[model samples]
Target: MPKPSGRGAADSSYAAGTGIAGRGVLLDVGRYKGSDGPDDSWLPLDANPLEEAEPDAAITLDDLKATADAQGVRLREHDILLIRTGAIERTQDPNAEWDPFGEPGLTYSDDLIEWVHEMDIPYIGADNLAVEQIFQTVTEDDLGEGRKSLHGNYALPLHGAFLRDLGVSLNEVLDLSELAAQCAEDGIYEFLFTAAPLNFEMGTGGPVNPVVLKATDGAGEEGGSEGRRGRGR
Candidate 1:
């Protein structure tokens, strides 16, 4: 296949047959208001849905930093940030609608992208099907006259900016409940993370089972009894 038109084309570091290893931080936005339940509008007619849990809320860069601070974890370079919005958990319910097109996820904005770049993190993953909310209405007026719609002009603008511009790889539809549970139980947010992509030559994307390892000792400590691996979906 022809090379994709973005940073991914130039950056061969995360290509298939390669492995990415680094410290990881799980930012649990799953239980955050408006993220715990499915949207009624997207549910099937016969499907009985759960009650609306809470009001809608968007996670900002500040929220990420605050959550890390509260967990006594520091964001550092090469950290693989995993954001859990609890969208995956809802899909596990037989009655819940798994609408890939419309779902709650990180609010995409220029500031958010800048924040990620400033952190110097190499990769990011999310529990939602897409890392950002989809199906956004962009009208001709929104584009403005004569200005061509760029790759970053879509609803999931970060996909283009991160993969194509910044050479960042995005992992989506990850199940993070177990990882979040482990983080909460152990009071540890940082872990040794490793993920290897399928060895497909010239492939754009493939499946991956990312793992997060935490030391048995305790949170923030280096040495521990043993390292336990938390498997991702």
Candidate 2:
């Protein structure tokens, strides 16, 4: 079916299960100070997750790769890589919980995109308002002493151009806590999943409520591969 654009939804073809699953890990990339103190983890709506985060503190690339390697699973070529930075976890209002992560993990940059290309990662999804964090602040430990910049806020560049313009797809605001736990227990980081995109032809982004269904064994359908692909660069 031809995908709609402007103001529509993606074709609702894979609204159900795909049957291939063993274990899946949820890497919560959300940013919080991880302190017992009062949760001073609030950031403005436009905060960036990369500014000065400790690599060991949040779900870094190494961690995700390690989890996937240990699972004896190959990430589905077109699977939605859900990234939860935990920003929305702090929001009290469900409707206003678009803030994805607090201040640690941001989305991929151009270099990160090159890494993605090298890794053959199909897609990226997040639970934050934007793919990156809102604030662009760095802590003392993030650098040494007087380093000016560590990581630039290149999320939109990666998303809008690399992913969007370069034909890769990105899904935002995915709830992956349970999925993360499931992967930890079963040692499976890949699953036969499906997501229906909002087919808004003229729209820049669409509202998507993706459901990550748990499958048993390769009930994976050869269907639904179309949405997995995008129409950019």
Candidate 3:
């Protein structure tokens, strides 16, 4: 190997920890509330499915709850929450024009941030560019008395809420199509999720390969853990 460089060598870092393994809970918001079918009763009754009117939507905490309820999943503390908004899938299509701005996914809210903290969720992942909306929405509280501004104060609030303040790690741009389809097919949303990030202790962020181990019946229809690739920019 060449001489060691910079501050450190043979070392790297990720938020909270270097690697993560946990009881992964997937809330497939795309399949549950996308521009598809409610084909069965499991679909949330009040799901504002992806459509023309709200192409640039932001999934609220209620949306997450409704999705979880529809999928029969009870959110637990320390559970790895992986949400699929289908944003990654759109990027794969040749004709589709994927716009990162105002993309539909989790956005910052008082209740949403509070719930994440109160639940003690250590990590969160999503199939979007940012786990939260890339273009954040501002409110009156952020505006204050004068036109003081929202550019900095309200831009991607979740970044500060989760990463800065809560110390929660966020994995974004995940290719969740395969996992979502598989989970929807078998009706099993919980799995053993494990990931080992490239060791870069000095760096605040690094890439990881997330693998999902799903339990199948003795019939052996499904085999073992499926390594889902992380979608790159």
Candidate 4:
């Protein structure tokens, strides 16, 4: 059951056409030892306006860029960009400062969004409560809602609106660090990826488990049966 690469889960082309078989590379964004959390080396909760009880320790954007560059893989356009924030690891603990429902750390900035947009990446995902830190904020002058119900609430407002309201989708909390590392080691970051969303017609969103398969290389011999899961889509 090999799939196609260079497209997102909702890319109509993949859904309507034939599939490919290559070396599967899982770009997981879950927590790992080398991950770097949000910048918290400065003020504490008492001093900082944003109420953060503690600092997050997860992977940074630099780590991801370096890893991808070293592997010589040009992050595929329309491919799933899995980011490991280590937030999910913390979420497992009841006493964790960051709440899954509330605001979260490890969000994407405008620069990151610009980069993704330039790359033509249709789908970007993270292994945290949000793809962009919920505490972070972004502006959308194009829309009527500006600087209201957005700041420090849902990380990047423009990003969410662009992804969701604009028809693009963001997959969140898909334990992907180990898988990303494996792909890093193999120097194969692109592969045929397939994710079956819950298919909730009435519901706005649902969970999805995506599987990556290698088609060009002989690595993913087992086919499209192997992969991972996402909490929300």
lDDT per residue for candidate 1 within 1-233, as digits (tens), equals 97655333434334545687888888865533333354321212112112231113345566677767777888887788988776666677787656665565555555667767887777888877666655333234334346435213255666676877777778887777766766766777787877876654445566766766676445474432222222221
lDDT tens digits, residue span 1-233, model 2: 99654423322222212212222234433322232112432233433345544443344445455545545555544344655444445454555434334533453434455556665555566655555444443333334435435543433445544444444555555555555545445544555444545544445555555545553333443221122222211
Better of 1 and 4 by lDDT: 1
- RMSD of every candidate to native, in Å, equals 7.1, 9.2, 5.9, 9.0
Per-model TM-score, in order, reads 0.71, 0.54, 0.78, 0.58
Candidate 4 local lDDT, 1-233, one digit each (tens): 87534324444333223322223334343322232333321111112214542333323355457646655766655555656555555555466465544433343444455556665555656666666555543334312334344334343464555454444556777666445545545555666656656644334456677776543333653333344677544
| Model 4: CA > 4 A from native | 1-64, 90-108, 137-159, 215-225
Candidate 3, pairs of clashing residues: 11-201, 12-200, 12-201, 13-200, 13-201
Worst 10 contiguous positions by lDDT, candidate 1: 41-50
**Model-by-model lDDT, in order?**
0.60, 0.44, 0.67, 0.48
Task: In angstroms, give how far residue 18 of model 4 lies from its true place.
Answer: 12
Candidate 4, residue 31: the lDDT equals 23
Q: Residue 74 in model 1: shift from native, Å? A: 1.4
- True-vs-predicted CA distance for residue 163, candidate 3, Å: 0.5
Query: Which parts of model 2 have CA positions greater than 4 angstroms off?
Result: 1-60, 70-77, 92-102, 107-109, 135-155, 216-233
Candidate 1 lands at a TM-score of 0.71
